[model samples]
Target: MKIRRANKEDVTAIVEMLANDALGEQREDYKLPLPDSYYRAFHKIDSDPNQELMVAENKEGIVIGTLQLSLIPYLTYSGGLRAQIEAVRIHENYRGKGLGKKLFLWAIERAKEKNAHVVQLTTDKKRPKALRFYESLGFKGTHEGMKLHI
Candidate 1:
């Protein structure tokens, strides 16, 4: 599989992978034909200098996985930058084949290229298996994550 920056044409496949899981099926609405909001968000991400929307494609050129990486420059941590990984999803058929780990390690390399002090991500607490997967990859639960929905 080849990992590369996602183009506009890959949005639908990326959305499909994002909606394939239980939590995603509840939160994503791809059934009624995708709305403009998705593309709009894509454009915003595409134009951002600090953000990257990436996709992993198989030999047939099908997008089988995707993730977004954002470089956050902050004053804390001695005014360092961090790479935040988000929206990581791999197609069901592609799971457990070491693709997820490859994707993460690739992101880490990209982070290093950007001179980030750290790489961070947040996973839903409901996914114990995912928690285990991340821990297996050497990520630690260093802090409690809280959210306030508007």
Candidate 2:
């Protein structure tokens, strides 16, 4: 397996994996000829120096996982940089293969390279299994995360 920055051609596979889960079925659109909005968002993220949209590929060059890491400079933590990881998804066939752990370890190291003070992520409350998976990776449930859908 190889981890690398994602390209425009990778969006479809990434979205397909993202939409494979139960919660994803409600929120992600994995249709062929995906809405151009996905590309537009990709371009915007690609242009940002602090953003790293990554994909993991198997030996056959099939995209199996993806995640987005973003760095935000904050006034707290003594003007520190915080790394936010989001949209982590592993293809159905790739789950339990340790691809997700490898991807996250890479992202954590990447954050350290960028001098980020901390790396954080939020998972849906609906995903208890994911919560345990995250805890296994040394993440703590230190704070409550809240959101309001508009």
- RMSD values for the candidates in order, in angstroms, are 0.9, 0.7
Q: Tell me the spans in candidate 2 whose CA falls farther than 4 Å from its real position.
A: none
Worst 10 residues of 1 by lDDT: 27-36
Clashes per candidate, residues 3 or more apart or on different chains: 0, 0
Candidate 2 local lDDT, 1-150, one digit each (tens) = 899999999989988888898988899877889989889999999999989999999999999999999999989989999999999999889899898999999999999999998999999998999999999999999999999999
Query: What tens-digit string does per-residue lDDT give for candidate 1 at 4-106?
Result: 9999899898888889988999988775467888999999999999999999999999899999999999999899999999999999998989999999999
What is the TM-score of candidate 2? 0.97
Q: Assess each prediction's global lDDT (C-alpha) against the native.
A: 0.93, 0.93
* Model 1 TM-score (2 dp): 0.97
RMSD of 2: 0.7
The weakest ten consecutive residues by lDDT in model 2 span: 14-23
By TM-score, the best candidate is 2
